[model samples]
Target: MPENLTAEQWRSFVASRRTTRDFLPTPVPQELIDQLLTDAMTAPSWSNTRPYLVAVASGQARDRISTELLNRWDSAAKALAGGLWGKIKIFITRYGLPQSDYKVNRKYPAELKPRSARVGAELYGLLGIARDDHEARRAQWGRNYEFFGAPVSLFIFTHRGLGEYSVSDAGLMMQNLMLSAHAHGLGTCAQGATALWAKPIRDEFNIPKDYNLLCGIALGYPSDDKVNTFKADRLPIEKIKLLPKNA
Candidate 1:
């Protein structure tokens, strides 16, 4: 264990970590990526099952996957705007429907909807995108498939057999990876949108049948774009804490 680490310092470091929406094209050194992965592996696993795998992409492979994902997104968007015939075409071609092992898009719960909406509003507001600007919004959303211009993209997978526990373990691992990257002057964005269509990743990687793609992380140096500076509000500690039963 490292010595002389104060709680205040740790808290400050953790608070500085944020989800980077824009990244520079500068590629992270392989050694640095390896070190971050090593640190992330220290996260405790449930029953030591460690039922998760990661697929890292950079250079040519990353570009190819990004191209494919963007193509799919474009086709899906056109289909959505095509009316009844478009719907029929999507059904016939299986183009618009997601082929993810798990559902990535779902209706938010009533209690959580406001939080989700608020963050989204703030993010788009930072980018000068109006709520009614469908075309602009679609273009922005398409960037997620492009890994937000990050040079490195990671796809996280969880074992289907372990169910929710596997997802929980993956979450812990992802947090560690992000924090480790942040500590090293790197940026990361954990993207659920990348999990919407797994076909592109499946085509590029030899992922096992038992492993389901959970999400993705875009890692690299953060760009100085104004969008990257947007910060969402967090709930207070009291709001998250449960009341004492005796009270």
Candidate 2:
């Protein structure tokens, strides 16, 4: 904390950190990235057990993962377009079907669906993508595999020994990483899409069997693209806060 920094300034800094979808190809220095991870280590873990591992990809390695991921994304998109038969073919072939350690594409709960839908709608609207523009939508979605042009990709994994607690601890660590990146004038987008195909990651990293992929983050300098400016609406405290039993 800076001696001159106020509480309001800190709040504003946090609020300003948005999920950057478009990033410049400029590579982040390895030293700076190491420092950011050091900052992330400050996050408290469950019982001081930081049961998380991160696999970093940059340069040629990043490109290799992106290539494989893009192929899977395209295959999955084709299967999706083919309807029931498409789904069946992919399932039988196991080509486009998610080989993820965790199910990344499960149906959202009824209560949470609207919130998810709202954010999607808002982002597409900002991008001038029409609701009926399936082709455009698929193209936009495919960008996730490309890491939105980021120069670095971080595959986050959690230890299965602690189960959900490990996942929660990883989430906290990721938040710290994102905040640290923002403070250092970098940008990041945490993408569940990256976890849709674990084979690509597994092929690239010597991850232990006890660790499972949770998600990935695209990291680099944010481009001045319009997508970087999109800000989803947040629920107020009243909406999220719990009421007393009597009240």
Candidate 3:
């Protein structure tokens, strides 16, 4: 741990870290990325297995992946909007269907629904997008595949044999990476959407067969756009903590 950081400074750093949706096209330096990865590697893992792998893409590789991902997203979006015929087309072609190792569209549990809804509402509201505007929503969602114009994209994968523990370890490392990126004056957005289709990435990177893509992180300088300023509300600490059985 670095010295001279006061409690307040730590709190501010943690609290100020937000998911940046819009980023400048400026690329992050390779040295800075190396430093962040080094810091993130210090994150604790299950038995130090460190059962995760990361694929970092920039320049041409990043552009190619983004193009492929956008095509996939567009095909899916069109199919979903095309009604019965579109559904039939998707079923017949199997082109737009997600091949994610994990299901990304599962319904939220009843207890967490409100929290999810609130965050979604806040994000769309900031973007001046109405709830009924499906086209606008689809376009905004498509930006995720584009990495919101960020210059660096990181794809994280975990070992299948390790099961859920590998996922847990990956999550820990991801958090560390995001925090480290923020401290370095770089912005990040951890995107689950990027994991929806892995073929494009697999073609670009020589990932081991045992490792499965978990999610992606977009890294770059944040733009001053108003949408980048949106911050979702967090539940209070009291709500997050468990009460003593006797209390």
Candidate 4:
């Protein structure tokens, strides 16, 4: 345990940290951004490899990336409607389809599917969006590409050499970054959808070929919007814990 840090304080802080889906346009200070990055560097890495890279964008750069991503989302959403015409559109407009370095669209395992579905249902419920309202849902999902209106977007990349371990290391670093942001009274949302279209980000930054875009984090002040209040339920410890063989 770190000095001056108590267990209760740590637990409370962790529990208080929520996934902020709505953000204010207020920009986070550059110095504070630097501090958060520095703090995140302290996260544990596999064999001290620290095989992760981050691309930060703010102001005009962030807006440009958001624009490109939202455009792609619009196309992708149309393609999902499913028809010969949708297929032709994707084929003609290649940029509308996924140009991801890694696969982002994946089915959840049977055990985890319900949890994922419940969270989605609850979020939409809070937003007053009906489950079958595909248009509204697509719009809500589109918010991910816009960084939830955050002023800053940090694109995380993991070194392909280390494979899954590098991804794990990146996840740890993101947790550190998000927690640090929360501690500073800033909000952050780790966005998986941001990884769906990496071309927009790659166009803006000179990312290495060996580094695969894994995810993104939106960093800024949270808005007063009701969406920010949604919280996903966690499984109880007993549900997750495995019993001893003898028992």
List candidate 3 stretches off by more than 4 Å.
1-3
Query: In candidate 2, which residue ranges exceed 4 Å CA deviation?
Result: none
In order, what lDDT does every prediction score? Answer: 0.91, 0.94, 0.94, 0.92
Q: Provide TM-scores for the models.
A: 0.97, 0.97, 0.97, 0.96
> Model 2 over residues 22-84: C-alpha lDDT tens digits?
999998999999998999999999999999999999998999999999998888999999999
lDDT digits (tens) for residues 131-163 of candidate 1:
999999999999998899999999999999999
Q: Considering only N, C-alpha and C atoms within 3 Å, which residue pairs clash in candidate 4?
A: none
Candidate 2 lDDT for residue 224:
99
At residue 117, candidate 1 shows an lDDT of: 95
Compared with the true structure, what per-residue lDDT tens digits does model 4 show for residues 24-134? Answer: 999899999999999999999999999999999998889999999999888888888968889887988786888788988889999999989899899899999998899
Better of 2 and 4 by lDDT: 2
Against the hidden true structure, what lDDT does model 4 obtain? 0.92
Worst 10 residues of 3 by lDDT: 1-10
Looking at model 4, residue 122 earns an lDDT score of 91
Number of backbone collisions per candidate, in order? Answer: 0, 0, 0, 0
